[model samples]
Target chain A: MAEYVRLKPEPGRTVSDQLYQLGLEFPCGGCSACGGCRVRLVDGEIPITEGMREALREDELAAGWRLACQADAAVPVTLDIEQWSARILTDNTSVAFEPGEGFGAVMDLGTTTLVVELVDLATGDIRGVLAGLNPQGRHGSDVMSRIEFDLREPGVLCEHIRGALGAMLAEVAQGREVKEVLLCGNTAMHHLFCGESVEPLSHVPFSSPALGARTFAGSELGWKAEVVTFLPCVGGFVGSDLLAGLVACGMAESAEVMALMDLGTNGEIALGGRDGILCASTAAGPAFEGGRIRMGMRAGDGAIDRVEATEADAMRCHVLGGGEARGICGSGLVDAAAVGLALGMIAVSGRLNNAPLRLDGAVQLSQADIRELQLAKGAIAAGLEILRRQLPVEPDVVRTIHLAGAFGNYVRVESARRIGLLPSWKAPVAPVGNSAVRGARLLLLNPSRREAMIEAALRRTRHVDLGGDAEFQEAFIENMRFMPPGR
Target chain B: MADLETLRQAIIDGDAKTAGAVAREAVAAEMDALTVIQQYMVPAMDEVGRRYECEEFFVPELLLSARAMKAALEPIRPLLAASGAKPAGKVVIGTVKGDLHDIGKNLVASLLEGGGFEVIDLGADVSPQKFIDAVQSTGANIVALSALLTVTMPSIKMTIEALKAAGVRDKVKVMVGGAPLTQQFADQVGADAYSENATAAVTAARRLVAAG
Candidate 1:
């Protein structure tokens, strides 16, 4: 499904700006610092700048590959747009709801991806769905960078995301009478959406002043809806998405102690039950999403999405598209690390016995890649440990561990435990796919009790600031090893 | 004297309690503090650095060794000062402004201290003026800058420019390191050196001091 686009650059704007209008992603904030926005010139010519020269190899330059961030095409030019279409996890849980009139839209505004679902309120039937890369990625991929961008050019990122989501909601509504819209995102996304100052989130302790739930008249957002509501966040780093995840996982009603983990660049973890909950967010880095690894990528075609070890200690990689393995994704990375440990190619210290263990043709797991995983998983495991200590129950009393997000849904529980990414508690781990959307849908269906549930969840949860926590620091250092849980 | 071999092994094994005990015994015995550090402690750290470079040790191990070295150095630091012995070098370090992530920067600081540099850690979200004032007040010969986020990286360049504007750019060497940083980026931002990890950071700082 390859496509091409012909673009005429507007004055005072780079080609990346035009591409962003075309719903393209600039993973590096269009800074020309990364090669993620590279586009192949199919016809005509565009002047190359120093950024293009530095980012592209000689052969790539010879083949007309150019970084769109640095190019401002004066003449109309055709360019190949590869890696544009991406599959976002949109599976939702089926829950009974009290049917009402009109329609409602639910949105899960993630840092890297965005998913919106249109549903009939009366019958609780889904109408349409739209999922794609969040256009604000052109600003920055992570929340910290997005905060910095907003600090410089206030309201620019807000305009970008609001406009994008507004258009999407309108498209999903399709001129139907949409009564209300509900959204859930991280603290940064919530602040950006509300045009609130992100300065508080840019420092240690990361407590934001504007982290409360907000309701907006659809007229303000230029949507033909009655009202729009953003769910409230738990803490500075622990977002409303996790709160929605708690609702989706039925943690608020369960009397038994439980845990919910959404693993990503920002590893959000919660431990507790109806009595109380402790939530903390750890900077897990980009290793899980394949950002810092040498040859890591998203779970897509040609990407090694899974890895297994044979009895003879040989690795068997399963590519996403059943082709040659191009790179390893987060799930595959976890599995490979586990298999490497099983075969003695990796030590408990995460040291590779032989550096760059080849998993497939030209697809190898380097020593540094293993270190990245170690740091990422270590932060997550440490966060969980810290939260577990704060709970009233014993460590072994965690009845269930609900893994949220796409990474949690896809990563094997055994490999995660082997690498100490998940704890050794006997609680059966369950993958809860896209719980934020599911929770938002439930809230949309039960508008009468939505406010009460939000109040209850807020009252039952306490924010744990892991920054500068001595216990967390010690646990992080101790958990950085690759030893199996309970070791 | 204090069975310095045990002290050295304690540091290598990252046994902070044993390292601290041995160093305290050495201090009580009036063993020359400089001799203890140069002969036993620095070699242990060097071995740690070597292991880190060769991939035998990771960040946790490196951090543990640094902690053990810190514990061992505690009782000896006052003795060395009383003996009028000089430190290897004076370095000023901080995470650049608007960047709160400091784990990597802290590791680099610890390793630098273990490597025998007199480090003045200004902590995270450090403004350019703070760095300049610290250099002026402490007379630090080297400035280490770190930033973890891509958006906060330009502050490293701004700090360099501020150092130039303050007319102290030529007085001290500028070193930079972070997750989103590269050698090319360091050079682009006018940093004199870029180290990939904590051990490399110590080596770079030492090299910068030696070159001057």
Candidate 2:
């Protein structure tokens, strides 16, 4: 074949027309939401097309960055680039929490969402609770996208996240006299709060500078609280959230093997036993938070709480807050996937059955929806499989499967196991709603708990890069089959 | 004598074996290979590309057609080579530093290669110096950079600056793609092209080569 350099015809073909002809599949329909089209200039100065100038920054333009899907190869050019992956931390040291008399607050700053709780330091009672989407989500749905924005424009990220937390705290406090504050978040979040650069967090052999927890004055974060403590990060991907969950669930108390999973935007899993604890985090992406999916939404009012499909192609849904269905939440999605598989509305490979589901409104799960659910479930299951492979005994040896997080609280445990999202074992599954918040609250209530949490964090060993595990990929493919292995 | 109509129909049917046999017969009858390609194979591939763009055909279909086109072109390789027909352009592609994901990058490479670009893939977690070296060694006119993480985007800018420092900034066009990059960010990083997907990358590369 004549290696014809498919060049843009000057004064003849537009970049868009050429791209369309090239058969490019643009996810997001080029809505400019995801930055999947970024490209760079390598040879001979090519003028920044209007779209390039609009999508990128001046520094980026000066640095030869462009969106490959948007940029026209009409001009002479050479481009070098690759795909980026999310990084997780594994090592963490114990932190000390000193509780004082008076009202205090605990916060869990998650990638997709943020939650805050007001606590009475003397009694450990939660006064009020508030949850909302991370304001920085407007930049990108996931941590990687947010980090990308931060890299392009310095300082904006820290300010944006801090502002969001400040607003959330103000709402959750609601006239309470908040004296101290305790924060639990992933390593990237901690770094952003401390005004530390996240450059290292995204590189190979990812490491977080803050291994143990640290106490800072509330004034440091422009707050009036007397004390502010940032919980120590466990590892790059495994953050205080998992540690806090472990503490709240009392995973270290019993000698029996226990598996603790904090399922959110990032799925962090830690399996503990008499020998030691092994943990890993998976970039489950933002499917839980409804980022990439077509009809996904957060666990909020008006979101679908449950779904069931019947043999007659009939679909039923339960809405949260007894209102019209806005979208499907994470819990509802899990249920729908399991139920759909059970009812034969979806095939094992996550393909929607040829028979279309009929619902009251526009609440049917499409083929794409099933695929997205499969991906999310695959990642979680794969993480568990990786932990099992590293364990000495069989998965059944694990005594308990503690499900942490708000979404975990509502998920159907049986459905989760039915879909192979969790290990098929006789171990008890307990739902600890917002364990990170609870652990943070405990730290605020009892100063002694900080030492225990810190010890647990330090004693834990983190498993790196679930993506590299061949077992994870295998599990992902198998789990994507939606149906039971024997079936 | 067989006209372009009959040959075009054969190409459209994806009859690579028959197309090759016909092309060989035509050449033996003193017909031009370029005429056969421009009049038949390219048009057929264009149809396949169109079907792909319309979603009527998926990756498997596209791959099949591309294979067919390759098979048909095999018999005319000597004629094109003897004519010293140069590729439309050359590109070096890789994932940015700190990133090991390559599914998207691999897809883009496949589409670009199918589009007839001489692509030198650098795989994943490629450093700025590696990109420069690839560009220098391959004499590629375009550099396609992919990053799936926001944390590694700084490396993209650094690579661009490295190319400039090597005093070869004006010698090639740089393109960037991934889940976090935007056209605006691409411009800020000084990239010449920003495609949203693999198919678009091929289109963009072709345009860049043609513009040159």
DockQ result, candidate 1: 0.30
Measured by DockQ, the strongest candidate is 1
Find the 10 residues in a row with the least total lDDT in model 1 chain A.
Answer: A85-94
lDDT of 1 by residue, A142-229 (tens): 8888988898899988888888888888877789988899999999999999888888887655787788998999999887788889
What TM-score should be assigned to candidate 1? 0.80
What is the lDDT for A71 in model 1?
A: 68
What fraction of the true interface contacts does model 1 reproduce?
0.53
Candidate 2, residues A1-487, lDDT tens digits: the string is: 0001123345765543343333222322343333445544555445666766777889988987766556555565444321110011112223333446778888889887687767766554455556676777788766667666776787887888777777777766766667888898888777777677776776776775656677777677776567878887878678888877777666655468888888888889988753677778888876766656666776655677677765675667777645677777777777777777777766654556562343335765656566566777777887787777777558678888888765666677877877777777789887765678766665665576667556755575555566445566556555555656443
Chain A TM-score of each model, in the order shown? 0.80, 0.74
Among all windows of ten consecutive residues in candidate 2 chain B, which has the lowest summed lDDT? B55-64
lDDT of 1 by residue, B1-212 (tens): 68999999999888999999999999999999999999999999999999988888988888888889999999999998899988889999999887776778888998888888999999988999999999999999999999987767888999999999999999999999998899999989889999988889999999999999
**Could you tell me how far off, in angstroms, the CA of residue A440 lies in candidate 1 after the best superposition?**
0.6
Clashing pairs in 1: none
